[model samples]
Target chain A: MDYDYIDRLLERYWKCETSLKEESELRTFFSKSDMPKRFLPYKDLFVYQQIQKTVGLGSDFDVRVLSKIEPPVVKAKRLTMFVRIKPFLRAAAAVALIVLCGNITERSYFADDKLDYNYKDYKDTFHDPEVAYKKVSSALMMLSEEIKKSKSQHFPDSLYQNDLDSVCTK
Target chain B: MHEFSFQDDILPLKDKLFRLALRITMDRAEAEDVVEEAMVRVWEKRESYSNYDSVEAFCLVVTKNLALDMSQKKDAQNLSLDESMAESEMDESDPYHQLANNEKLKLIHRLINELPERQRLVMQLRDIEGESYKKIALVMNITEAQVKIDIFRARQKVKQRFLEIDGYGL
Candidate 1:
């Protein structure tokens, strides 16, 4: 093979006059195993270029780049989702806040009506109506028994017992 | 105007972004971070992406800027300057053919890194990434002619240094 073409191309390449096509041609010629001995240094340069081309990010590079850019993409999806549901969420929150305020206001208004009464007076009474009625009935029965015992000395026991039974039954 | 799909467009460019970032930052973790940051920035501006001529070029610009910024901050902090400088020294070694292929690769990577920032970036975009000079010019904010000149100078530097290393071996 003639060496003149490659030599000329090499000269043009060194002068920065070679086009991309010619430069690539030089690269290809140098890549072949049969490169001329005189062109060995240039081969090394081209080989260096070839090897440098292979110099690249590690395989994890994509993952790293994707990870950096991915969050925003997911965030964009999330932002759209947030935008879609924003009105409903705001309305729901407003409803909840209104309900809470209504409850608080109602309790405050009712609280004023009972301020005149001593709260301690009601503290002694049973809160359940049924339990309070039972306690009153038992207290009256104990008082009647005491009265009947004390009056037994001045009246007939049978008469007092009959009257007490009628009253108790009623 | 094309809608940028992370999976279809941005994700696939990870290797290219990583290579450019790695070349500038010279630290794998930092490069990964720069690429990730660039991806995030691109995604954030996704709505405005159609305003540009090319998404890939825009992304390259962003990654290059971010990597440059991060490296500058790293230098300011002086957090691990000694270790980083040591690593940089290793990367700046000359490329000699007598060395193993892997060693040559490492040496050339260092050599390229040793170039001026503009030359280094142009070399990476044009030679290694196989980007068209137009795209490289877009990313670098330079003219097509300037891009060619930068690549030419960078290659010449590599050749000269490479020859020096080989002559030492001889």
Candidate 2:
């Protein structure tokens, strides 16, 4: 049990003079159970460093990290007949929607055409020409009265003409 | 150009990246999150991985930056190590020895954690993960000489504090 080499390597290790391999040797030497009493104080440090090497994430760590880094490998889900036809199903749905919409629109348009045809077959509510002429005259007279009231409430045409003349004179 | 497969190449680095993240954040959950984000970030740039000299080094850099950022955001730099998480697989027949060893392991963890960020990271990358100086320097964005300096200072501080604690116990 000569520990001269280990002691020297330890000394060099403290001085940062040992190579990585030499430092590794010191670690291996300290890892043994039968360490010299003089080296006991420092043994824990080396052994702890060795143990720290094992301070890794759990077995699930790889799974967790790979899930993040590997991009969820989108395992080509064994495309069942249903899955295989998914795109076609989507297209078929879109086409069915379009056809349904088209049918509804066409039916609505036909209903509108029927309404238009009914309008073309319209009959006058007033049957007699004399009664129709009297109603038209009264409606025209009321419209003219309303128009005259609105026009009077606003600027009169004579006033507007005076303002325009003033501006022209100016 | 070596074809870098995510499963074959990058996925395998998870444990190493986890350990690095765990070292920085001192929170298993936060560390896991950082590692996940780093892996996803690297995977996103998988197309440009060939442009880099070493994808592994690039991944380490990404993990380090992400861990540092998260730890800073949470202000978890001074958080205590989760003793339960550090359970070693070593089967010690004697309960007394196991308790003593566990105590020593805790002290060692605290000592390492108390180190300055750069020194702690350098020591972790070098002594624990068995990374080369070149790789560590690349990951830390420092010179190889600076990596060596930090590691030396880190080792000295750990040893000094370990000795002080052991001395006080006696």
Candidate 3:
């Protein structure tokens, strides 16, 4: 029997020129028991690869891996419009409660007191314009005096200038 | 687009992923762990599966990365392929042929395992798994040229080593 085809294929295989199909053919040819004596040396290489193909994990491997892995995510239930908006609705309700409480507290603490005060009876203590003018002039004079006293206690400009001049000179 | 189901689409790829992980980690238990983690990761990103060109390629890439990480972390030792397992797979009736075939198989395994990591992985993906060069490139994050080069180098090395042993009766 002529092995010229297999020899040619094997040469191409070692050269990395064989197509996947041709390589499979070589594997098949080498797998048989009736190969010529000269081809026996190369037989083991192909046979070993064939055997390695069968080297795989046992059936239990699937169970082991599946147990470790999470199952495929179940398709999510279609949410109703209300269900989708529930979180936003809760937030809006919280905000509305806060605002309502704020309004109530403000009315309790401020509105009644403001309304009870009599704005209509708010008349000026000084009915005469001349007397009111004199009281205003006196208050202004006291304020002027206090301003003069504070000005007198201001940091001395001459002392500040001296410190500055000394530092510059140094 | 066909719907991607974890049970139908992804889980069936566990054996392929396991073989890839096993090739890298060189330890069955570690490879199993890597494959499990990879599956879980792919499941976690299931929503984005459609974004990828191929979910199978994506799973392979994930498994490769996890296996690399595990192997690196442990400084993967050169664990021999289980001989008993291979023996059980043999259906030979003659004891003489079985013994000789087993020795040859062992030699082939050692030759492959002795290859550099990238070459070993490329050969495994190309020869055993029958992956396309494009897919191997995607999984390994290398150019198709580089994948072919690695496969070529790996096959040549195995051939050279096997010839050296067989010729000298080592």
Top lDDT hit: 3
The candidate with the higher lDDT, 1 or 3, is 3
Better of 1 and 3 by TM-score: 1
lDDT of 3 by residue, B34-130 (tens): 8889988998887777645688989998999998887666644543335433543363553322433577786777677768889999999999999
Across residues A29-137, which tens digit of lDDT does each residue of candidate 3 receive? 9889998877888888888888888777677988877777756778979999999999999999999999999999999888746644778888788889999999999
Pick by TM-score: 2 or 3, better one: 2
Candidate 1 lDDT over A1-170, as tens digits, reads 66899899888888987888888888888889886789876677787777666656656767766666665543334468888899999999999999999999999989767565666666554578988898899999999999997877677879879999999999
True contacts kept of each: 0.80, 0.86, 0.88
Each candidate's number of clashing pairs is: 1, 0, 0
Model 2, residue B89: displacement in angstroms? Answer: 20
Write the residue-wise lDDT of candidate 1 on B11-127 in tens digits.
788888988998788777688888888988998997776645778888899999999999899888876745884765565342222232565655676678789999999998888
- Relative to the unseen true structure, what is the C-alpha lDDT of residue A63 in candidate 1, on a scale of 0 to 100? 70
Q: DockQ order of candidates, best first? A: 2, 3, 1
Per-residue lDDT of A140 in model 1: 100
Instruction: Give each model's whole-structure lDDT.
Output: 0.80, 0.81, 0.82
RMSD of each: 18.2, 11.7, 13.2
- Per-residue lDDT of B113 in model 1: 78
lDDT of 2 by residue, A91-133 (tens): 9999999999999999987875654555677877887999899
**TM-score for each of the candidates:** 0.66, 0.65, 0.63
